[model samples]
Target: MAATTIRTGSGPLTPALAQQIAGDTSHIVGFNILITDAHGTVIGSGDTSRVGSFHEASLEVIRTRLSATHSAAQARALEGVKPGVTLPILLNGQAVGTVGITGSPAQVTRFGLMVERQTEILLHQASLLRSTLQRERELEDLVRSILAFDPLVTGHSTLLDQANDQGVDLTASRVAVVVHTPGRTPVPSTTSEWLPRALVLLRESFQHRQTIAVSISANRYVVFAHPTPDGMDGILSQARHCVEQFRTHLGSDVEIGIGTEGAGPTQMRTAYEDAADALHLGRRITRRSVTTIDEVRMEQLLSGIGLRARQRYTAAVAEPLMAAGDWNTVRSTVIAWCESGFSLVGAARRLHIHRNTLIHRLERIEHLQGWTTRTAVAYLALYLACKTNEFDAAEPSDS
Candidate 1:
């Protein structure tokens, strides 16, 4: 049966929910149920055929905010209704809809009241869910605006007003952290479905602190956290804990990048970019799940050079290696060596090769390319080229 529907000037009750109430309540109570909006029209009913009928008893209940019942004999007098009990569905003490059961008044009155209470609870829960979603949307919009804000623009005052209304203090010092799931599978991909799950998982981690978290886009979540009084060291420590919290719930696939701390809009925006860059570098180069801007500053600086120029530099520095298809290995070797502090033993261990093999490879590079990592200039250039290639490959192709 169809449940009661809300039409123009009907009620906040939607036809879909009314039908759900009618179908579910009837199944549970083993009786036919009819749901009516404020206008007394059945939008949903356990008996699908009765939908769109008017129940005069329901109209009276809506008007009086009370329950009405009828004996089997009295049921004949009411239009579009049988001998039953109808109770107003109250939300905040106002009737929004009615739930009616079809049976003798004495037999159905208790079940009618039970259905009424159930419908009211459902309506209230729906209202709360709507409110929470709306607030989340508003908060996301606020974060988007703040991230896009430019001090030279005229909208700063308006943005400040909005932030003030939301009880967000823009002047407070905050460090931006960007969390992303690069290739999420076996999990929801839809932003609306995915965001809440992640947020709920991280809610406990954020409960003690002031954090403004939002999903800026698909798979990209940002959290502007208030830095603790202990400064950079303390903030990073907190960020590590936060990363562990995320990974514990979300799994090892999650990656997080942390930014520097500062107050106001411009710095906050910069911090967001910093965190994003850190995440990019961490994911592409180190394959690390948690990365801080401070840890990747050199790579970040190297990334500032245009991809084309960096490509040219890499080509120029290792021209012979490129021609012989040895640059890829050299690049890997250089990055690993540099990262291992140019220690032959550590570099060999990192590459899972013997020291003699490493020495022979270096000898082959010098003999064929005449490029040795013996001097500071040569080592630095080679190191930068390797780093540049990592970032360059990560960059999206302009063509």
Candidate 2:
């Protein structure tokens, strides 16, 4: 019985693997098995005495990359022949070893072929798994190297070279996108699994666009993409799409922030910071799923002030209202009124209430704070205080 070999460039099957195959097949077919390397020296065998022996038929099978069967009489006529079959084991399109079975010609022929097929399948799976693991490690290392880069340093030639080696062009124009998954806890067990899935989804969505995405933390991911002529609009659209996909998969809301496009590796640090700041300010100012740097640039500026100064500003303008039981209501009324350009009708319309109701709310706010929204200074103070309160709320605790 002759069968064509499938050549795969995998390494020669080890004695341990061969012995495992023989042990497993022994229970099903009840045949004595011998496993030989490409050199035809027996490395594994059901019969212990046959190990280290040479088999001519196994050598022939390896040389021709085919299977050979021998009848009992034919086996007896040849020196060191077995009344069974010898089959070449092929992996990655190359013959790596041979398997021989000693039993009745008909029984061993069928069983030996089955064993050879099983061994090839197992070896192929093992090779594939190893390759996948290696690729994942390489990808992770590349991401780490990129994040570790300090653009402000004088000598980044080594980092640039390493990035080039990984097919990432650090000199190209790139914009950073930060994805924030709200309410996600940073538990290692869950985040480790979740990040890979998110990365896969991002890659699939932006693969043709030459995007690079990496996990920055348990609930944050950074994606770099080269923007087209459409500029921030195109970037915002891509970010919105990613957030929508994440929402569909995770069944929860996600917010995305996009930074301005910047050139070269050094600018990546600034771009990443911009994206993160946009994300934070966007969550505080708007309910949109995606936010771009342009949308929150003013908030970004305001946030740069010292935290203590901002807290004092909040105290000076909104201190009286802060002690009220309905502080949130008072704050919302002031924000809506300011956002409406001090127009009672516009504020009432925005709040989905009658104009009279809005006037009552404003009067209550004025009474509580001892200041009416009449003068330009009053309007300015209230606006600044509202912004400061938001900034304070978003600030991380010192503890």
Candidate 3:
């Protein structure tokens, strides 16, 4: 007769199927199904009343990591209960319990062999699915960590705010602080021990859970910290302290910039930008020190110049004038003009120079450089050139 396919029954070994399989064998096919907990406590079984039954053989299956086998004789008194192949039932990739068949060696072995073969296929498929699920979870965790960053830092606030707002339910009461590691050497290529150590210091000092989403670039690491009700000052102070503690390892002077505190998940990017702006200022102005975006009041004045333009302006004007020795005076003059709305009168008054003296200097500048300060455009260009020249003067020759 065709073998009965009891794929689904009262779970593996019901009395009916067991009797059928037992009857098919020439010898007695004695068997018992066992169940156990994570700690080897038998909780239940296919047998009706085995609810609290405990079996040493069941424990052996877990401890020894071996497949089940049938035999005419039991192994030993202390070997738990020995029987045919013991089929382990697993949940969550852990063996929670097992099923076993016992009887005459030949018939029991045949039955066990059949059951073990089919069970192996099922278990292998299950194992592959479990592994795939686990990998998916790990990938999700990494993505979540990256998305948690406030994207407003890179000059795309409106778009980032909308996208993140639609995608995630972000906490509204948190703030972001940007810690900038200057130069190429101080920062490592990846987020390894040395980099993570700096992060640890920041988290500890601020008393917040710190998460490194990912590296923004080779030289920039974005740190997200929840804002405390104590205020931005406390947050900034902690950042300052953290930087100071790890100053030596950081290579370049460590400058921490904090963004403005605000509400909504969309606000993170804005906050990040604020902090980054603070860091940028800190690096350029406060060399070997810390600076905050709040302290950089001329963002409005410097708004029109992009990074590349600013660099070129600095190299062209500031570098040369600085090299020529009157950089300090030129800087004072340009700053006065920028601060005074580019009015020659206001600039002169601020510098305590006579209008005629200012006029004469202007004339001399035009004559010496073949450039005129007659129009607003010319004045603006001169102003930018002068500022660049000033910065170049301050920089070392190698820089």
Candidate 4:
């Protein structure tokens, strides 16, 4: 067969066929055969020792794109050796790769041609199968990498859920940010290319202060943070700055949206959704190249309730306490209480205080805020506020 023809009919060579070809051509003494890609990468070989060795002959095949016969006497690397023919496997009238045999010059010439013919067919089949399998693996990795991300596109919640299951000390102090490239088409051919690089960059930036977990999907990347000694705002600001710097090297059309703080992975899903929402808002309201979740007014926590009723409820019950500037402390206390299952000890632990100290803080908040833990209405409002207030502040502006 013409070398070009063999190269063109690329297909995965079955082991059975490979063994058969090897057996048929074993008559030549110590004949070694190697198969490689156009780039000279060894893909397969008859000798196990050469499995990873570079196929130097691939360059000759790639350049000439034709069959070549050489005597070991004439070749420096094969000096005082046999003669063999290195046949290029051609597919679609092009040199895709090569296969060859080495042994006695006269006997090698005849046997090499026959072996070359068989190896050509085998390697062609092998190449096709290898290509298909590679493509499948790439697809699977893409899906996994994408799903590992916290955003809906990435399912970051799933990963965080795992962290929680492992009994990682999860708390509101831990935070994450979801950054998206707005209005830019995602990398069309592969999802892994830029996502991994972005994640590596994020990890490097967060290395000393906190653990950063990254997830990448078709369109976005979510960064999950382990508890950090630094303040959330400061860590977030530094992360954002890093992302901005990274953006400068990306394709010009790239845009990014940053999510608000989230304590752990479970809550990260909500944060991711919020960030996506903010990105939507960014596309609509701002002309800036990057947007942040905090920059968007969060959806009304009580939007489900009638506006008049919500206003009346807040005014009558929450307004006076909130006006005293003790709203956050009270709200945090209530959340701690509820989250602790009303266990004074647990709540105290969460508050990082001794039980007596916890009681003192609770009593002071109750007295100053007029929010008694004994009152069911007070408790309920506090719960709702805790559940909802994390994102209720007025939209932030420019950082």
- Highest lDDT model number: 1
Q: What is the TM-score of each predicted model, taking all chains together?
A: 0.75, 0.63, 0.43, 0.36
Better of 2 and 4 by lDDT: 2
TM match of model 3 to true structure: 0.43
RMSD of 4: 15.3
Off by over 4 Å in 1: 1-5, 8-12, 72-74, 151-154, 185-195, 250-252, 311-399
Residue 148 displacement (Å), model 1: 2.7
Candidates 1 and 4 compared by lDDT, better number = 1
lDDT of 4 by residue, 1-399 (tens): 112212322344433444445545544446776566676654455564444445555677678977667765554564221256667766656776666676555655665556666766656666665774564354334324333454555455555454455434334444445555545533423442433455555566556443444445544655555545566555556566666656655443434555656654445556656656655556655645456666655342343455465556555655655777767776777779877877899999898878997788667756765654566566666666544553333234542
- On TM-score, the stronger of 2 and 4 is 2
Instruction: For model 1, give the RMSD to the true fold.
Output: 5.6
- State the lDDT at 88 in candidate 3: 62
lDDT of 1 by residue, 80-186 (tens): 87988989988888888789999977787778767888888888876766667777898898889878888777466787788888888888888888888666522
Clash number for each model: 14, 8, 8, 21
Q: Give the TM-score of candidate 1.
A: 0.75
Each model's lDDT: 0.78, 0.73, 0.54, 0.56
Residue 123 local lDDT, model 2: 66
Error of 4 at 148 (Å): 11
Superior by TM-score: candidate 1 or candidate 4: 1
Error of 4 at 391 (Å): 16
